[model samples]
Target: MTTIKQDTDIPRTLQGLDDDRSSVRLRAALAAGTTPDARFVDKLIERSAIEPEFFVRDMLTWALTRHPVSLTLPALLRELRSQGAQARSQALHTLSKIGDRQAWPSITRALLSDGDDDVARSAWRAAVILVPEGEEAGLAAVLATQLGRGERETQLSLSRALVELGDAVMPALRAASTASDRRVRAHALATERLLHDPDAGFEFAIEEAKRVVALGGSGQEG
Candidate 1:
């Protein structure tokens, strides 16, 4: 049932990924993923780095995930070193989705604490996903350093990442809860609360932590 449209789909789809309109690019990414061709891999990674729209970039990541890891892993690891922040963030996001442990070694401390909040957030997510066995404590320690680093969204991302490491993060959270910076202490307490009660929403945990910090409590109250 191959029609002329089927025959032409490959070239048209590749070109569509670069179309001026984002909708076109989005469809192009979808098409590329729907029927993956190795030819689409490099172009997908390139476009993911510069794609302005979040949805489009997300589609691009989805498309990359559709490809084989052997094809995607090296390119993604190289992207971790890319000078562009979006490239690094997108690569980390994509790698997290891939869930390939082989990519674990590339998740370095510098990326975990990247100056850019988005990059750091993506790194935190990827690190949690890719962290090797027996490494959770070390990873948690590094993640704790970013406690209270940015705005609410960034702090929430950090807290969730720490919480994902499970009880292995307790020592780090305990140390951070006693830090001189009130913001860090509050964030640590909030993260500890989430670790204990997963159902407690971040907003409530953080507000309650703020109250504890205000009262000079580390939230380890008996």
Candidate 2:
């Protein structure tokens, strides 16, 4: 395991995060979070936007969470508007982990429907986490627009996010189940199944929904 020795100088620590080795960058991120320095916030957020390693990016988010929201929130909110998809995704992810409602308004519909699947997925997760009280249904409506948007993983992510909203998503799911798009209706039906049967696997539900769609039948039929 690579380790970065404890250091007082922030620049050296920030530089460590950019090391060529993933292990070194991981250690640097861990060190930043372990120490919780405000000066490291910008570096951490910048690194998070472009970090190639998932574990390292996750650590950077952890590091950002350790800092004061007063500093991290504004930076994260700005990152949400960035052209880089990873930046917006990571910032949304960190904000979700921070659980700041003030950042809720920044979770825009454009982000929810972002062209990038990863960004849209992260936006869905973050929106579910940050949505204000009484807004779950509205958020679900927006999310429902992407029912058949991506592949299995993306569909599952959307399903989980909607399921996390509990009954609030029922209205949106119901509306989507009636969509003219077979994929959208199938996804909505499969999601509804998972919503009712928590033990049901998404793959099984989705496949069954597909079969139903192929047969020109509503997924409501057993």
* TM-scores of all predicted structures: 0.95, 0.94
Model 1 ranges with Cα > 4 A deviation: 1-7
> Relative to the true structure, how large is the alpha-carbon lDDT of every model?
0.95, 0.91
Off by over 4 Å in 2: 1-7, 220-222
lDDT string, candidate 2, 77-183, tens digits: 99999999999999989988999999998999999999999999999999998999999999999999999988999999999999999999998998888789999
Across residues 1-222, which tens digit of lDDT does each residue of candidate 1 receive?
Answer: 566666689899899999999999999999999988788999999999999999999999999999999999999999999999999999999999999999999999999989989999999999999999999999999999999899999999999999999999999999999999999999999999999999998999999999999999997778
Position 116, candidate 2: lDDT:
94
Error of 2 at 30 (Å): 1.0
